[model samples]
Target: MEELTAKKDFTDIYTQESPYEYLKETRRLQYRIPDSTKPLYLSLAEQLYNKLHKPVNVLDLGSSYGINSALMKYNLTMSQLDDFFLKEKELTKEQARQFFQKK
Candidate 1:
């Protein structure tokens, strides 16, 4: 019972907002996609892509800073990944939209 209470107290700090809201700020701290999982994720993506026979617009809820987005895209499309690299290379640090637009 004491342990439960302690857990609740810890949870309350972030529960003022929904967990998803807190996640927007803290997900990177607690959640990480291990490198070993990449191959599994890629295999799953390949299976789904082959089954559907088309590109899928995947909405990754609670994604931390788009790391999952990057991973999923890497699995799904090589051409797109190449294009993204090309675009990123052309952008200066100040022109990098990911950091600038978030704020």
Candidate 2:
């Protein structure tokens, strides 16, 4: 009972928008996709591709940053995402808008 209550109390923040609403001003709540789970997600994507026999359109519900969408659509690894979105190249607002528009 005590462990269940503790878990519930810890997860109370998910019941509201305050956690994600602060992203603009504070990156304190960044999503560091666990390396261990990356392979699992990638394997699942491959399985889906094999099962579908065509392009797979996946909707990662409640994904605020679209990380999973990019993974499912592009079959990318977390390192690739870190490189594309955070490293490798930096773009301004206009460049980012144009980049997405081209896609």
Candidate 3:
């Protein structure tokens, strides 16, 4: 536990004003986004919905920038997200909002 707690602090990276930087840093380190587990999550959500006969809500802990939520809700892959961020790196706030509205 001590060794775990002693790992290099990444608060600065996690607290960035833009998620672009965080994604870039993680991509640089070749960190996998666990997007492959989307099918499992979807399956579980479907089961819950069927059992409850209603829409189910999810709580994604530590959901920095809501990558998981975006992936699940928008049916997006990590590669697509990376490409989108790279291509739209210079988008203004309103432009970004419009983009999502179209999605």
| lDDT of model number 1 | 0.45
Q: Please list the residue runs of candidate 3 whose C-alpha ends up more than 4 Å from where it truly belongs after superposition.
A: 1-9, 88-90
The true-versus-predicted C-alpha distance at residue 62 of model 3, in Å, is 0.9
Error of 1 at 1 (Å): 29
Q: Between candidates 1 and 3, which one is better according to lDDT?
A: 3
Error of 3 at 50 (Å): 0.7
Q: What does candidate 1's lDDT look like per residue over 1-103, in tens digits?
A: 1223332223443444222333332332433443346577668777898999997566666543344565555442323333343344344545444532443
Better of 1 and 3 by TM-score: 3
RMSD of 1: 10.5
TM-score of each: 0.39, 0.43, 0.78
What clash count goes with each model? 0, 0, 0
Candidate 1, backbone clash total: 0
* Residue 15, model 3, lDDT: 79
What are the runs in model 1 whose C-alpha is more than 4 Å off? 1-34, 74-103
